[model samples]
Target: MEKLNESMAWLAKQDGSLIVGHGPFVESSEPPADGTSFYVQDFALQDAKPWKTPSTVERTTIREMTMRFQNAASISCGWLPLDAAPFSVVFQEVMSSIHSGIFEKTVPVVTETGMADQPAGFAIMAAMTRQPLPLHSYGWIDGDSGFSGATPELLFALDGTCLETMALAGTARSDDREVFAVDEKEIREHEYVAQTLVSKLLDLGNIDRSAREILDLGSIVHFLTHIRLDLQSPRTPDELIRKLHPTPALGPLPRTAETLSLLFEWRNRLGCPKQFGAPFGLLDEGKFDAIVAIRGIWWEKNQVLLPAGCGVIEASRLVNEWRELRLKREAVKRFMLPL
Candidate 1:
């Protein structure tokens, strides 16, 4: 733990250099992008059309990138939206989508409190050390753009021909695990996520998923299902990512054209940046470990971005969701403030 803290401090102190460190592992990029190009191996570009299958740009291994970052002098941050979201407009859109039957279960998350003049790196380091999560805590700094947070969801982890993942949904602010585990609304929402992922895994291998259980993350509780897949043969990590992204936990069901249209419309209404999942990906070698970038602060220059999202179903209430978002944000906010 102490070594991890030391490594985080070393990465954080590197000004103008690109670095990403999670747990005992850290990766870095040289100097910085030419101030225009943002080099990210895990995430896609913002302008990527949702309908089109985006092409992947090959990236160097972490070992190579770390060497480059060490040799480079100055770091430059990448381009991301600095605009604030209009929550009211987004809330209305969620209601519209449910009424229009455009979505059965979709996540319409918003970024609140934009462009604050603060450096959240130390805060992130402190929070990560104090509250280590199973999904791992990651922080990245690119000349100008970067984000840090401990995720609760592991998109997928590959070991040889075996793969492990989870369906994490159904948020509750209660401390009592029993209450959260048995809530009907939460159970239904969790089932949507788990079932969706399980079906997709069938294309690659035989799979098994545990029944829903409570995942206690200090202040919050969620319904979680563990999934294990035994692939017929080894497959590339990228292939699995393409197959599993935008799950019902993150997007709407029936992954179709009509639903995607509604998803983007809601994003535009909420001013939700494409960077919601930014800085969220994995460490790939023989093993591929990745997490969903849900809770965290994305920072660049003097601007600080807090991104949060929630799933909306037919039973969702606007006011209740609004309050839920507040609670979600507060979970991270506690560690972000001065201790």
Candidate 2:
């Protein structure tokens, strides 16, 4: 690998190994017949050629990569606090739709912007590589612009005839874990996501849905339910991704075209990054592992964006949802700091 200044992509696997693609990457509409290919797509799944064949690929541990990363100069950026008025408007619209039976749940994002003195790609990449286990570190950097983060939500992992995914929702501060575990409103929000995911995969194969549990990530906690399936037959990566991309966790509960359009309009109005909440993955041979592209930083030159989303249900309170968004953003900020 050359350095963070060049184009590169990476996805960490469940086995504690990181697959890194050293660029210049070649764009492809189909997965490579051999070797590893990094998959990158926008939240709307608009990219037609989402596969990128790296000039070089390497498998390494996070610790090894962290040591090789050169520490860049301290990044100095002034961040603006996100205004709550806009989010409140979107919240009202979402609640109205829910009451009208158009949607059971929907996630709306709030983005905080900042201006850096210089490009921050190297620093952000280095920080993400330092994140500990249970959180998968992923990134794609091209020149002075890119995104990187350590995310806890896995979209899915396919190995031969088996597939693994999880429903990660219902966020709360780590201190409030005990109360959050039994909170009725939070539980309902989580169940909406878990049940929707199961319904989608029921026809695919023999399914195993684990009991809902709490995932504690230092400053924050979320409800987590692991789901597995033994497919009756093989399925293509693209097919599986399209079927599961915007799960209720990151998309509308009743995922219809009209509902998704409304959600996209709200997201655009809020200035959400196109790639946030999208599927970021790596296809190595026949296996694939993808993670939800949340809890990350996106930048172009000196401009930086930190976006966080809160799932809105009929029972969601504006004040509580606002607080939850901030909690999520703060957790991402922690990734930029030394552990």
Candidate 3:
């Protein structure tokens, strides 16, 4: 607590580039990657941006990160009225796509807009401390446009010749453990996520992973499987990230035009301001790690938007899927929203 408070105190004072370790896109002029020797600028594969592999990185330490936090100018958070109609429309599209055989699995992210009376520092602290999951709190403030959130899904991480990733799907309220544990719809959805990722990984390396298990993260639970990739040859973290990003968890499987159309509809009708799983990358020591920036907050001007998502399949119900999306937001709300 003392360490966190001190970090916050330091953060309230300074300005310029702010990159909080192990979180989504913060302000760092250099390419976004983890550690020295190797760094990747666009790990999230944002549109046409190409991957950058620089020889060196301006190493970010805990003290350096603390200094970056000090750089943010003081500001109050606020909210705006959210139109919930788009979610209904997007939900309908998801069902339509699944039934038409365009997608076996699709994920749609919904945003809840509002304001925060507190400082960005407090929000970051609350998220890191309150969430019991592998949740990592992240934030960035540049002029008036900034975003922050607690993310539990790791896109992929590279440590030497071994690569690590997970297929996270099928979310439910934490208390209803059995529902998530045994529900057929949830189970099939979870399997699709894992199977799709495994097939993608097989093209790049040899796979060694355990069976899926329930990974309970306080307010929410998900079907998760920790994956390890033993490279058949050798591949950079950058190489593996490109192949694995926007997994079925955030977009669609098979990477087909029909499946991607759902995402376009989401952005056009549902008001998804940016890509869901694209936000954060970290290069620490010699190891590199990056996460899908889901289940977090996006801040611009005085407005704050909290976002959450769920995988939709043929068997998914409208009411249950909507409830699952809300529950994912509730997990984030525990920290971002005032008690």
Candidate 4:
């Protein structure tokens, strides 16, 4: 708490440039009366390391994983990400590959309603998901910095050595950003997070199924839940974060193996466009933090680049998903709206 508070205090004193598009802010005075325009910007770090390597999975291994632990989990996810993602130095290389572009895609969707907002990028890890505020971050350039992001995801983060987390949700600044819901199908979809996490926990030891879902914080409303485990037995917080990382907010839907696997290796990927190419951040430990590279625009002086995408589920309607993702492109629309 002290560490985070101190950081916030220091940020307020800076010029607040390190954060421009999608980072956190201590307190915002008031958005421009002309209203804010939305655009995606993929900012990369000056120098960085790699993300974690994924576990290699084969058909037999996958089946074994399902057979041994599927039924024993109290909070299992339906997603099964293959253990073959870039890990360690490999991921750092992935992050370092920012010059060519951060593999970013931003779409601009302008609707006739709402204040014209943009959620930037969408991440789906297994279950725990959030439409992260693109403007939530901490840093400094020269002697100035501050946070952005309307609905800041981390409601309470005590970064005193061990990181404790609390999230918030379900408020709309305007219709530019779309919120999430956990309907029956969504619960089923989010099972991916639960599944992945539970498997890792089971590997540690006994964790009674005593946890339940609860709201992390409140304003509008979002389906929230909490998972509890005393990893002190033989496991550690480091282990938990390692195995259960790529939180739903930054990856894919819950209950799946990976959120943005090969995120760069999908079909029809070029369908959308890149708003900004450097939306990247480095974490305390060499991993990449989720950046709102989605809802941004790249304009060195007058050139514009936009990134936007939609959630694709088996139940996802192609046209409807397209429309929804379009609505998310409001980050730039904020600039083009009044026109």
Best by TM-score: 2
- What is the RMSD of candidate 3? 6.5
Q: Pick the candidate with the highest lDDT.
A: 2
Task: Give a tens-digit lDDT track for model 1, residues 49-89.
Answer: 21111122233232333343342222222225433346666
lDDT of 3 by residue, 1-339 (tens): 222222111111011222333222223334455543222222235444322233323333334444444433334455465566778788887788778878887778777777666535444444433333366544433335555565778888777777888988888888899866988988898888888888988876779878889988877788998888887777765567667767888878667766676576675456565645673555545666666777666655446777777788888877787788778876766654433
Query: Superposing every Cα of model 4 onto the true structure, what RMSD results?
Result: 19.1
Off by over 4 Å in 3: 1-44, 47-83, 118-133, 337-339
TM-score of each: 0.73, 0.97, 0.77, 0.38
**Which segments of candidate 1 are over 4 A away from where they belong?**
1-85, 114-118, 337-339
| lDDT of the structure predicted as candidate 1 | 0.59
> How much is the lDDT of residue 331 in candidate 2?
95
> Which prediction has more favorable TM-score, 3 or 4?
3
lDDT of each: 0.59, 0.90, 0.62, 0.28
For model 4, residues 1-339, the per-residue Cα lDDT tens digits are 101121221100011222122223222222122322111122222222222111221112212322333333122112222122212223333333322344221111221212112221110100011112222432211112112222223311212222222221122224222334434433443354445445555654444442324332222223333334444444332343344434433333332323244433231233223212222232222212223223333221122233444333344334454444444444334422211
RMSD per model, one decimal: 9.2, 1.3, 6.5, 19.1
What number of backbone clashes does candidate 4 have, counting pairs of residues 3 or more apart or in separate chains?
Answer: 99
Angstrom error at residue 263, model 3: 0.9
* Model 1 per-residue lDDT at 27: 29
Q: Compare candidates 2 and 4 on lDDT and give the better one.
A: 2
